[model samples]
Target chain A: METKNDGPKQEQRLTKKGKETRARIVAAAAKLMFERGVAGTTVEDVQREAKVSASQLYHYFQEKRELVHAVILFQTAQVLSAQEPLLSHLDSIDALWSWRDAIVSLQVERQCRGGCPIGSLASELADSEPVARAELASGFMKWELAIRGGLIAMHERGQLRGDAEPERLALALLTALQGGLLLTQVHRETSPLEVVLDAMLAHIGSFAQS
Target chain B: METKNDGPKQEQRLTKKGKETRARIVAAAAKLMFERGVAGTTVEDVQREAKVSASQLYHYFQEKRELVHAVILFQTAQVLSAQEPLLSHLDSIDALWSWRDAIVSLQVERQCRGGCPIGSLASELADSEPVARAELASGFMKWELAIRGGLIAMHERGQLRGDAEPERLALALLTALQGGLLLTQVHRETSPLEVVLDAMLAHIGSFAQS
Candidate 1:
């Protein structure tokens, strides 16, 4: 009887440990993925990074695809974290431009290298299957909405112009960053990216009072 | 003597029939890449689509990677072709705006789908190997020069404000498009992307005669 009940009871008992081990595996995978493109990240590499044996890695996730999906979700949340606080403070034009500048400066310093982990993963996963593509799509929707909501809030406060199109600008800003990053990465330089950001900032400033 | 003669003979031998066959193979490969994603495209599927036997396919290209490289070069040329006359005609703000609009409209309609194929392939292939990445990088550099040259021409004609920074603005335009594409593709919408374009256009217009 005890043996029969142990299956469910065993899972419950192992829940904490299971979660920790799973997180370790994902972190390991993410690091490897960033250091070497996803295609270069082998299952064995991930297992070794996590300090787990092959069987243990497979036990947590059936395959590398499943693990990658989990990582996408994890990375999306991390991106959001970086954009917050500053985002929430955009109640005035000063705040918005400051936020804009913050974004531009950060990207310039970083030289638009690497990529948005979520965006990068989405490109890979979307072309493969509808299910995975849907997940990738969800991350974008959520990201866009976060920015849109802030823009709308600023508009309502009279800090933004009455005609300000927040959602549209937000989408465009996101897109430019992505494209700019590609160019910057290819050239291993930042001038082109800076030009785009400078133009955007000037445009955004037009809606704000001096 | 035989080896030298064969090498030169093979280099010169792209007969009409052979050219058509090679074209078919590349077209099939591009379609498969779009539908299945680059990683998912298989040599067998490409051969089937082209309706060629394995021996014939291998005869044309010694390996699948060679076929892919050919496809990339072909696609790079296609994109450049689309932008040519416009690229050469950016002698005024109106020309620049019209050119920008054409690109934005094309992208938004596609819902920011795919991405700059050259850039996408480059990002994925950068970690693939140095030689492959170098080839990919060359394509993007060519693209940048094409636009930068246009901007330089516009400036020479005194169409752009003397104080204006054409190179930087060009980079910004490209960046916004990339980011917008990612956003639109992920969200399955175009409104956000258009907003970014509008903002980008408005920004550039500030430096125009109008």
Candidate 2:
């Protein structure tokens, strides 16, 4: 659990308008990277999409790697925020199922076009970019902890079996999710996501107090 | 379940030497793609690594997409074949655990450098290349069928509970593996794969007959 404070330090020095410009640039980069991938999207593409000049983009991000790091943090927050109250309150089996339904429905609505934003980043940059990989790993750790929080609450409440390990269960659920999304994205169908999440939830349910 | 006859038809017409040359080019492409990614590796890189003339490379693969398709098939076969009799015979829980050990050990031996070859490809190319996505999906389907074959055998033999669905269980196992591998690759550790797979096996074990 090594925590690295890799957030862009330059953001602290920016004025209100400068911070707005930086946020806009990161959002533009995130969108393009989501659609065209990190390698496929260029600095020029971000500049053009954000309506910012090269100097402005560079001022916010020293290079593409810095921008990609910003995008990872942006996506991490975006994804977890989107999961919201559901992710924060997985203390019961019913709540977990509801969370699963929310996730699957969102994928179906999007037609499974983009897999997990953090996951796609991990797949592409894990090996080649060590710094980015660490950031992505940290992002996943945060996600796992969020899932673990609910399971731990259930365990503490005596809702889960005494032998049930919340940390392991949380990791399993996240793994199933990442795998399901990958398959769903590849097949362009929601069945894989549905099947995997259902399976994980069923496994979690098995530990519920009868 | 639409099967596309997308294999290079011209490969069938090649002489032994021509086929060897084609394979050499493909093996090189697969290596580069695995190491550098589909976008990072260029046709020229493959030509240089394979030590084949551009004309000969083109003779086998008319485009990068075709080459990526070949790599998908290559890695699929390579991965599945490496699993051997274990993948083909998952009749009992012991057998299944043994298969899990084999997979986990391989990841450890490789230091988890390359995630799943087919998985990484699917992550990178699934959305961008529809044809490759279909082929990668087919590869996953084949892998799933192999896993299902064992569970189905167990069900037929009364080793599993009557309510256990082999297809769903198999897909769940695959999903866990894919997710585990992705996380393990990002973290550069085998614990994620081990934890997720162990949870999946525990779930499957719940259906085991006494």
Candidate 1 residue-wise lDDT, B52-74, digit = tens: 99999898878777777776776
Report the TM-score of candidate 1, chain A only.
Answer: 0.81
TM-score of chain A of 2: 0.96
lDDT of all the models against the reference? 0.68, 0.90
Clashing pairs in 2: none
lDDT of 2 by residue, B146-198 (tens): 99999999999988999999999998899889999999999999888988888
What's the lDDT for residue B46 in model 2? 100
Off by over 4 Å in 2: A1-8, B1-8
Name the lDDT value of residue B82 in candidate 1: 77
Docking class of 1: acceptable
lDDT of 2 at A63: 84
Clashing pairs in 1: A175-B179, A175-B180, A176-B175, A176-B176, A176-B179, A180-B175, A196-B172
Candidate 2: which docking quality band? high
